[model samples]
Target: MATTGESTDTAARTGEQYLAGLSVGEREIWLKGEKVTSPLDSPELRSAALSMARVFDLQHEHADEMLAPSPDDGRLVNVTHLIPRSREDLERRRRAIELTAALSGGMMGRTPDYLNVTFACFSGRSDVWARRGNEEGAANIVAYQKLMRDGDLSTTHALMNPQVDRTKPEAEQMMGEVSLHKVGENDDSIILRGARMLATLAPFADDLLVYPGSDIRPQDGRYALAFAIPIATPGLRFICRDSFSKQRNTFDYPLSSRFDEMDCVVIFDDVEVPRERLFLDGDTVGYSEVITDTGWRGHIMHQAFTRAYVKLAFAFGLGHMIAEVTAVNRFDHVQEKIGQIWNMMELTRAAIVAAEAGSFEDAGGVWYPDERPFVALRGEMPKWIPRANELLQLIGGGGFMATPSKADIEGPLGPEIEKYFQSAGADATRRIRLFRLAWDYLGSDLGGRGELYERFYLSDSYRMTALAYTIADKAFPASLVEQFLED
Candidate 1:
């Protein structure tokens, strides 16, 4: 728990400081079938960690835009942790988020800024926690927020319980299927046992936050818990999915090699959660309210929308580059497909602008991005992202499939490749590099994962659209529609 001194020189962490914290943690992370001794020793995991470190370095480089003076300690912290009291504050936070997304080309979904703002949202409305008679929880939130801001901790969250028999009540779900649950409570701590899924970026995160998803029911009190723990906590093990970045040459798997934020299933076997770490426990109402009443949904989605927009922009740029190399930029149909992607990118950008314009302060005086634009963006993204990939693949054709490997270009067959593989104006190596990037985004295993990630990252399309409809109904009530019908 290092504190930032009040001196102006004490500001947000540098890339070196962030990496040092990650390098020494004793985390139990499994990849494939074996235990990973040190995450930094693994090429894929280390690359991802380095990618995140770049984000911290960017904050230091653009301190005025990304860092702001903390009210608690006059030292500057990342703008994402600032509790917004006005629209101007919200705009500053938005700029910080957008800049982070651009730095990662929007591929890094769980950038540290997202959760920093989430905790900020909780601290912004501590009274909501107090209403549930958990003043200690409220205090802990404020303290945790300051700790994160001062230490510049990176976090990943596991909110969705393991997918089991969804039709069954959460209480009826199989033993390990329902995620970390309260087994016993002592004076100082509560013991938990179970597992949580889709802990994205778990290997790179310094800490983990376990919270209830949108599906928690009233009867699921024992399962309805929210807390944070160090990633190295005893008895907490992370079983990772296959690493897409493993052993692939960087030239072949550009995106995956650098930006594979490994997803994991976190199993907590009798993990002890100290009272101070518990934000909500056994209270289903409080668990739900922590999300709904705290204004987290709008704020978190604002970050997501910004990231998705940047990701799409990257896809569009990739497509444009490919068209130029392939000499298809002149073809009408190719131009039409590029236009489609451009339109999607512009719409996503517009949604962010519109949401900010409609930003409003809640009763607690915390400014929140307008929910309507987010709902619309979330609803359309599932289709738009997949389509963007498909267009890239369609335009790219066999170029994506037939590109020479990095080894081949430098091997004995180099002359043959140079002669036949060269494009209109580009040489063999340049053409292959551009197509390889396209493959990474559209044709590789990493590309497939990106599609699936975007499709469900925000949740299912049906639910998202329903949420949009719900917001529209509230904005334009049926009573108002009745007047038009009667006239």
Candidate 2:
């Protein structure tokens, strides 16, 4: 507990300061074969970085909405730190998710604090976990939570291991093969090697949080390790691929206008992490069971809802645009399409809200979202939302497909374009601009990938549901099972 000005030191730290401090790693990053002095300076990464900093600034600018005081230490903390002691706590946590999601415009926007709470809720009652908890695991959870509360830093997760060799025995997973293993310890730190893909915010985070995913095989303990390292630590390089924004020329691209930031493949080339930051090491079986079932599903489901909300917002607005442009706004079919979009939106919201409301209390006076509704919703919604996007897309039609460049308006073809393609009542010029806005998502990066993402998301959630079932053995009543078998 540092004093108020410094009290929690975590409390007063704003998004701007965090972005300023990120310069330490900028010198190490290279984009397009050139080094950058401030990673935040690049247009592609800058949007995401600014988005990150905006979150911090938001804490100050919208303190009541973005933060809450943690009861554990009376420290003013981001709502990401909230542990639902009751349904109200759970609702507050969901609202926090909503606020941040809205702020990031639902673009890959969770801060490090998101994972911090998972570690908190379970770790706070490490004793129940210890009910049978290995003392070491208990200690590990507590230590991790402390660092979390201190706002020690931002971190990204490496959950999806790169699929390198499917033909090999599950025992020998060797895709480019960058997994953590104990090489030898320096006097003060542990060294890690091997690389992991899709660290969602790794490119600009202070630390990288590597933990075992359910996909990890127990024999592959080397890959089961969990820990963190500074973004510029020796031997760690963010061998990130080309930016998604780089995939296009800026003039016609819309999703690239302000989205697609902070995701990259982080390659750890035998990097060393200070001991204090290490939470779990070489305990794959333990890490898998703990992570996959312990509490991840709840947080993960909550995190995805942010995207759902964003997509819904797009649909509502896009639906109306579609109806108006097609001269069918007053038509029953068009109105029905619009209604379907709203129904899907409300459905997703209900799932998220219900999951939070039904959360059960835990022993430490803390509460956690119950898995049944969440798991059910997680399994069902991803499958449902793509249809909404599909409806939005179908209604959009050729207007969605023939998106013209923004520069076209200023070029020689401008006058000819205005003469032919305008919507019913609007001028050709106005229609082009409106269609372009629709094209941004309906035809461009956000739209093209959105429905696919929903399908992928639904498919992924389906797998997670199976994993939960496998872990909990279908939440079966074993005593009754044996009795039935005997009879």
Candidate 3:
């Protein structure tokens, strides 16, 4: 509920301005082995890019809820970039994150706001970087936070090492087979080479952050680095996976047609990261500490939980609608299936609310949402998402496969198709539209990709469970139970 000082005075741009910025960039991107001149060149990529731009436009309209006054200047900036020092600030950020997730129907995973919170976390604990005797690195973190906040820049990240042979250690693997590393550094910049996997939304973003993933050993020093660079940086190329947004008819593939954020393998063929952009270099302890000790993980998890909640709500609503159109809402078994989805939705909603309600301040005076609910949400979502999709498929029955195409609805068979496809309460067109949407969400390639994304979005399941257990152990120490036991 914090409005901008003036529409013209705000730092954020409208959706059109964001699109124009992307159109002029000379970034390298490839899909299906061909070089793409720009994301706008492909209809699918362009739709995804436009969908992202709408997030910025939403910020402009709801500036009071989304924007907060910058510390250095009076210009209103995004709440995502706010470094929360009080409980109210945390609540404000939670509201902003919810609004953005709702705008995209919780499908746009690498929205600019995600990284905004990352930089905000770094800025809050800038001294952690300073402790490495890299004062410049500390300054860079603060400056980059201001730069992105004031400019409203969109960013994606490539944190995972390239998935090659997991048996070999990163240090032992061949240079190209391992993750990105610094091969050379000059007085002004460092030259990076090698590749990083699964840079989601890289082609559509304004910048990319290259950072260390978890469990990095000290021997992997060359690969332990953190920095940000423009997407158009020379030698920085994105080799993309197939685009799911390629659907021409929005009605047939409603969600995929607009929300397919193309995932890619970001290749850095000697890309130059200027000294000013470097946040960490060869400091394995510092690199690991920055994420674990700075409350950054909690902040990022907060955004993820909020987004997942919206997605669950969307899925639940779709299931309910499907039951109505199919006239199966009356059946006891069908109602029970719907009830299962409803229960998951309610649980997710409770996690989001509880996380915020139990928010507490960290050692640095930054208020973070309670980690327990977030960790639980992360652990449960992988299972719940697939089950929810299965429920939709079950309720849909053969209708998911038998739905008519857009062309069929408008051609010679239109009348016959309509007469036969009409359901109890809905006409043929209405029934077809609903089924098509459900198919796109549950049966299409897009839906398949989403299931995979949700399953591993936070990382491997066993690792996540271990992490949750570790947190719980510390919060409720095992020694407490020993005192009550009889010897």
Question: Would you list the clashing residue pairs of candidate 1?
Answer: none
Model 2, 30-119: lDDT tens per residue?
Answer: 566765546677876776676678666776776676566665565677766655577776676667667666664454444655665566
Per-residue lDDT of candidate 1, residues 273-332 (tens digit): 999988888778888787778898888888888888888899899889899888998899
Off by over 4 Å in 3: 1-8, 175-177, 474-484
| Candidate 3 structure lDDT | 0.84
Model 2 TM-score (2 dp): 0.83
The 0-to-1 C-alpha lDDT of every candidate, in the order given, reads: 0.84, 0.63, 0.84
Superposed by TM-score, candidate 1 places the C-alpha of residue 382 at a distance from the truth, in angstroms, of 1.5
Better of 1 and 2 by TM-score: 1
Model 1 stretches astray by more than 4 angstroms: 1-6, 175-178, 474-481, 484-487
Across 1-487, the per-residue lDDT of candidate 3 in tens digits comes to 3245534468887888888878666889998878886788876688988888888899988988988777776678889898887768877887888899887677777788888888898888888887769788889988998898898898899988776877776776775445788899999999999888888988888889876567578777888789999999899999999888855778777888888888999999998999999998988898888878888778888888778888888788888998998889999999999999899888877887787788888877778888788888788888888999999989989988768888899999999998999999699998888888887776788889888988997896677888888777463465677667857
- Give the winner by lDDT: 1 or 2: 1
TM-score versus the correct structure, for each prediction: 0.95, 0.83, 0.95
Cα-lDDT of candidate 1 = 0.84
